[model samples]
Every structure is written in structure tokens, then in C-alpha cells.
Target: MAQPAARTGPGPRRAQDIFAATFALLTELGYDGLTVEGVAARSGVNKTTIYRWWPSKDALLGAALIDSRLFELTVPDTGTLRDDLHALLDQMRKLLTGEEAGAVVAAVLSAATHRAELAEVTRSFFLDRLGRELPLFERARRRGEIRAGLDPKTVIDLLAGALWVRVLLRGEAAPAGFVRETVDLVLRGVAA
Candidate 1:
């Protein structure tokens, strides 16, 4: 006897739906406010189904963090370091100004303080996705677009660190001209 046709697409599609729902819920409600039950309700899946895939909400959200293309900002290569940096900064300005950013920041911070796995996942996601920008700096240096002897990692840190300081520590939003000015200051050191 011929067996019934094997089911296809349901597992992967359901997983994607779950991740998307989790991200949406995280954005709407901070990590502390999120719950598996809410995600199940939102995704139309039973709570047991969520538990079977993800051992905890942190794990589910962690997976969602990597899956979501929300942080995939455009990093253009304009054949010149200055122009490329400016374009990247412009994209950052748009991201930083968005409502979702605040929510993401809050969720990550809260998770970091309470959940070790979540913190690791967040760090890994940032390093994997954002770290690619380092190559842009390296290319600029090789092409003599920017000063030689510059450390790509250091430069990336400075760029992201400054923005983080402004947003997380100072509680101020990045201004429109901040990115251009930042690139200039970093490339050409301050002078008396």
C-alpha cells in the first residue's frame, strides 16, 4: 500500500511564524512583559508547541533576534571611505530614530542583566551582523581613501561606541549631522 504524501513546509513555516510573532510581541511589550502564552496566542499556536521548540522565552527571542532582518541596515560602498561612512551613518540615523530601536535596546538590556543565554545571543548577533562593516574600513585604507595604519576594529568600536554612549548613557538621540562629523573627526584627528 502507498503511504500518504509526507507533509512539507509546515514545520519551517510554523517556526518562521513563531519567530515573527515573538519579535512583534517583544517590540510591543518589553522582554519583561512578554510571555510564551502571548506569543502562542498571537501566532495561533498552542503554548505546548512553543515550548517544544524553545526551552524558554529567552531562547525563542534570541532565535528571533538573529532571524529578523530588522538590524540589517544598508552599508553602501561608494568607492570612497568618506562617502561610504556618510551613507552608513545616514542609515543609522534612520534606525536610531525609529520606535522599534528603543524597544529592542530595552529588551536586550533587560535580557542581558537577567538571562546569560540571551546576553550571549545578543552579543553574537551584533558581532555577526554589524561586524561586517569593518571590511568597508579596511577597503578604504587599502585604497588610500582614509589614512593608513588605521585599525578597522578600533574604528568600528569608536563609531558604534559613540552612538551607544549618546543613546544609552546620555539618553539623547543622535543628531542628523552626527555621523558625518563623527567620520571626519575619527579620520582627521582634532587639531589646535
Candidate 2:
């Protein structure tokens, strides 16, 4: 494959093309099948440039996932832990059960099983995503909705696990009110 010369200077568009190509190929080819050369060719960015920006396949995919912001969650401050979690989980329900991004995530996660590269990137992606919700917990603590020491990570894991199981594993939509009930249960645990 003929490599396009690396773009010269100051090109966010270059990064955008690269990330878009990464996702496209990620969806088309499983992680084990995705290649920098493929992304470079698809994006019209040079493979060397992609490598310069990201040292390895995992790094490239991780950068693409984070930079794409495809899985971003909006954490709402509803002034109560239950409401906030309900809102958050509702968003998750949409993403996990929705068609587009959900398919991409499922592809990557399925590929992660056999590919260490995919696993590393997927792990970082999930952790960073979960970390982004920290302020929700922070605000709840300030409002006395939960204790300061309450572990948000566990709560996040549990809530996400519920949706992932229903949507990813069982291929079922989360029943109506499931999000709110899950939130209430988790909030109740931290309430005392």
C-alpha cells in the first residue's frame, strides 16, 4: 500500500480522519483483524504518522476510542443520588441497547477476549469512562445524598454490570423502571 505523506502541521482534521477510520475498521474488522496500515489507507493518513502518534495498535485504538468520544456519558446532578443514578443509568440503557455505538462496543469487547491489545485498550476505555462520573458522586457527597467515603467505583461497576448483562449478554432491553430501581437499591446501600 502506498503511504500518504504524513500531514505537515496543525491538523485536528487529520486526527479526526484517523479516528473515524479506526472506528470504521474496528467495526468492520475485529480487533485481531484491525491494522494501522488499514487505518492509514482508509483515513488517507500515513501509517508512519499513525505510528508516530500512537506507538502500538493498542495505543492507537485507545486514542481513537477516547478521542472519538463515542461512549461519553452525561452525568446529571439531580441533587439526589437516586435521581442522579437513575439519569446516568438511563443514558447507559440507551447506549448499551442502542444500535450504532453498541454494535461497535460489542465488537471490540468480543475481540478483547483473544487479543491482549484489545483488552488493554478496552480496559483503559472503560476505566476512563467510569472515572468521568466522579463528579456525580462528589456532588452527591456535598449534598449529603451519600457519605463521603461511599465507593462510587463499585456502584458504577454494579450499575453498568446490570445493563451490560441485559443488553450485551441477554440481548434484552432494560425493562422500564429497571434503571430507577437499580439506582434506588444502590443508593439505599450508601444511605446509612
Candidate 3:
């Protein structure tokens, strides 16, 4: 939940510095106006070094996101689907509200529309993360906490889609209790 520290010079910690710089630039210039030259200037890393690591600006941003650990998730096993989902949602709330990470997510999502590479990067990142959580849904189905017919993908989309609506489109933090309410609704519909 802590913001990454920006690097003043390149070394073993160069990537973190670049990532910090990238997020800072994203907040300042947005996706469209951001440039590798700008990032290099800010991070004190050479542009060629960045290019060696990432092929494009979008790729660099995606690497920065991964390096930030903002997208990392661990599905909880709390003996019931409802409890599990609440934990997952709560973690997601942190990712959305935490410094640097939230702004990076917003910038990437905003850029995905007109930038194909960025769209792919964003989609791939989410899909990969969701895949990691699928076993939770499978476990719930086996335990009959959720209906057997429910698709895990649909459930993931619903949960994450609602988050995107609140965080990205609405430009508001989800109201207090929104996570619990949303989990309850999804559970009611999918519960056995």
C-alpha cells in the first residue's frame, strides 16, 4: 500500500526507480502525453536501458505495473464463498485506493481504448490475475456454496466489472459498505 520510491540513479534498484518514475509521470501527463524520454529524464535511467527491458512505452508501463505488486492477489480460503469473496474484494479495494497503483490502473485503462498494445497489456494482466483466483470459485462450487452452473469467469467479470465502474467510470471511491453489498448480491444470485 506504500508508494514506490523514485530512484535518483540507476543500479540494482533501477527498475523500481523507473517504475516509480513511470507512475509519477502517468499521474502528471497521463498516457497519451507520456514518453520514454520523459521517464528516463525523471528516473535518471538511460532510455536505451529502458528499451532493452521493454519494447515500447506500453510495455514499459505494463512492466512498471507488475513491478509495483499492485496486481498481486491471493485468494482466501475462509470456509465459505461469501467470506472468501469479501476478503478478495477488500484486497481489491486496497489496490484501487492505494497510492500510485490506483492512478497507474486508471491511466492504463484510460489508454486501452485508443492504444492496442496497451489494451492487450491491460487485458492480459487482468485475465492472468483472474485465472489465479479461479480455483476459489471451483472450490466454492464443489462445496455447494455457489451454484454448480455458475461460470467462474462470469463471477469474476461481475465482481471486477463493478469495481471498474465505481473506480474508473464513476470517478468515486466505492461507498463504505459497497464491497459487502456487492458480495452479498453476487452470492445470493450464485449461491446453492
Q: How accurate locally, in lDDT, is each candidate?
A: 0.74, 0.81, 0.81
Kindly give the number of clashing pairs for every candidate. Answer: 0, 0, 0
Instruction: Give me the candidate number with maximum TM-score.
Output: 2
RMSD (CA, Å), each prediction = 4.5, 5.2, 7.1
Candidate 3 lowest-lDDT run of ten: 5-14
The digit string of per-residue lDDT tens for model 1 on 1-192 reads: 999977342376787788777877887887777899999999999998788768799878777776655556777889877777778766766666677765676667766888788888788777775576876876776786656566666766777678777776677878868878887887675111
TM-score of each: 0.77, 0.85, 0.83
Candidate 2's residue-wise lDDT over 35-89, tens digit each?
9999999999889878887888788878877767566678788887778788889
Candidate No. with top lDDT: 2
Q: Which should have the higher TM-score, number 1 or number 2? A: 2
The ten-residue window of minimal lDDT in model 2 covers: 7-16
Write the candidate numbers in order of decreasing lDDT: 2, 3, 1
What lDDT is obtained when candidate 2 is compared to the true structure? 0.81
Stretches of candidate 1 off by over 4 Å are: 1-17, 46-55, 146-149, 189-192
TM-score of 3: 0.83
